[model samples]
Target: MALPLVLFDVNGTLSDMGRMTQHVEEIGAPPQLAGLWFATVLRDGFALTAAGENPAFRAVAEGALRVVLAGQVLNRDVDDAVAHILTAMQQLPVHPDVADGIRGLTAAGFELAALTNGAATTASGLLERAGVRDAFAAVLSVEDGPGWKPAAGAYTHALAALGRGADDVVLVAAHPWDIDGASRAGLRTAWLNRDASPYPSAMVPPDHEVAQLGDLLSALRT
Candidate 1:
């Protein structure tokens, strides 16, 4: 059989979100609040998509951060902190396990690609900075399909770019919603359960579950 293509989610699945949190803390804002605000950006972005609107993820992140900052007393250089966060998103540090596992998977001959909620250029840049850009046959974004994730079309866009059928692709993500969305779009899914939660009753269980990308090699090999 032809090896199945493996697609990965970029943001939380591969990048360490600590950069955003640390940047805000240095600017005298609560670290957790910064993380919460960053998360709210994604929530609101997805909500807009669900409501038939499409907004840039960067815009949403900045808008949400500003709202959270409006209620707080910030004394340090706030704009610089926000800039750092945005740049961090563009040059995300890979999760410690990502680089090795991706290299291993590539060496094993599986075609690889990245599917992200960020813009196309942003995804390409981040993957380059993380030193794994060469492993991906393609880097895709929800922007390519004119909508955000869980929309079916987003995964469709990615699979189309890779010249692969949905069933021959395995979408890997840390978020349950991402996995569910990819599955709904007809791709096989592997849940990278960094947090190890049980699946909800209605959400389909992933084809395979692994705590880290390193574990994925053996699972996929089978």
Candidate 2:
């Protein structure tokens, strides 16, 4: 049998997004406030896309950061702070389990790839730094498609790139929305439930769930 293709989400699935909030806190900003800024970035990114605008993910993220920092009425200038934050983001560290889990999956004969809403540069840089870029057969971004995901086409394009259909692929992600979107596109779903959070009731149940990526490969043993 051809091993099931493994498609991963880049951000929360592979990397630790909470670190960005903690990074801002290290600079004397409140962690919750930093989270708010990060949330705004996601909101704006989707809005721009739905509006038929093609703002780069980095630019949308920076704009959201500007608005977030300015909202507090602090003396700090938003533009400079945004620049610092962007650079800091590029340097954000990955979770310790990421590299090993990826290696395990590869060793298990899974054809690996990534499908991310993030810019290709940002996603590749993170994986390269984590020393697992070589494990993936492909790394794709939504920029080449109509928009970022929650749109079925994002997952559709990703599966197409792998030259596989829904039955041959499994979409793994930490986000419920991403899982829902992938499922809607007819791919088997795996929820990397790192947070132990409950799944959303409105969505279809995933084919698999695991608290850690290390457990994921083991669970998928054929």
Candidate 3:
């Protein structure tokens, strides 16, 4: 059998978005709101997807940040705060385990690609900075897809772009929604449960679960 292509979700899956909290503090907003702001961005983005609208990631992120920063006392204006946070996202470093994990998967002869809701350039820059950009066959963005993920069209777009069948791909992500969406789209899924949080009851269970990205090698071998 041919090895299944590994489709990685780039944000929280490969990159360490938690560092945004530090940027939030540096910009004079409550650090904790960084998480809330990101969550709100996803919430609204998903809502837009469900409504048949596709908003750019940066647009949604900046709008959500403004809402989150409203009424908060910041050293800079709200626009500056939003710009600082978005800039921080663009410069995010990949998680420590990601490079080795990606390298291992590539060494094992499985094709790899990055499927992100954000700009493809962001994903490319992140992997390049981590020294693993060459491992990916492609860096994809929802901007080029039919819609953001969890929408069937997005997964279909990726499979078509890769010239592979859904059954020949595995979607790896840290988010339950991403896993659930891929499962529903007829692809295998591996959930990177770095936080050990319980899976959402409403989502489909992942085929594999690991606390770290490197653990996926062992998980897939079995």
lDDT of each: 0.84, 0.82, 0.92
lDDT rank order: 3, 1, 2
Candidate 1 C-alpha lDDT tens digits along 1-222? 899999999888888776777777767788888668867988899899999877888899888877778767776566776776677667767888888999999999999988888887877877788788999888888876868887887888877788899999999998888888888889999999876778777876789999999999999977
Stretches > 4 Å off in candidate 1: 198-202
User: How much lDDT does candidate 1 score?
Assistant: 0.84
**Number of clashes in every candidate structure?**
0, 0, 0
* Per-residue C-alpha lDDT of model 3 across residues 123-147, encoded as one tens digit per residue: 8999999999999999999998878
RMSD (CA, Å), candidate 1 to true, equals 1.7
What does each candidate score in C-alpha RMSD? Answer: 1.7, 1.8, 0.8
Residue pairs whose backbone atoms clash in candidate 2? none
RMSD of candidate 2 to the true fold? 1.8
Stretches of model 2 off by over 4 angstroms after superposition: 52-54, 73-75
Best by TM-score: 3
Best model per lDDT: 3
If both were scored by lDDT, which would come out higher, candidate 2 or candidate 3? 3
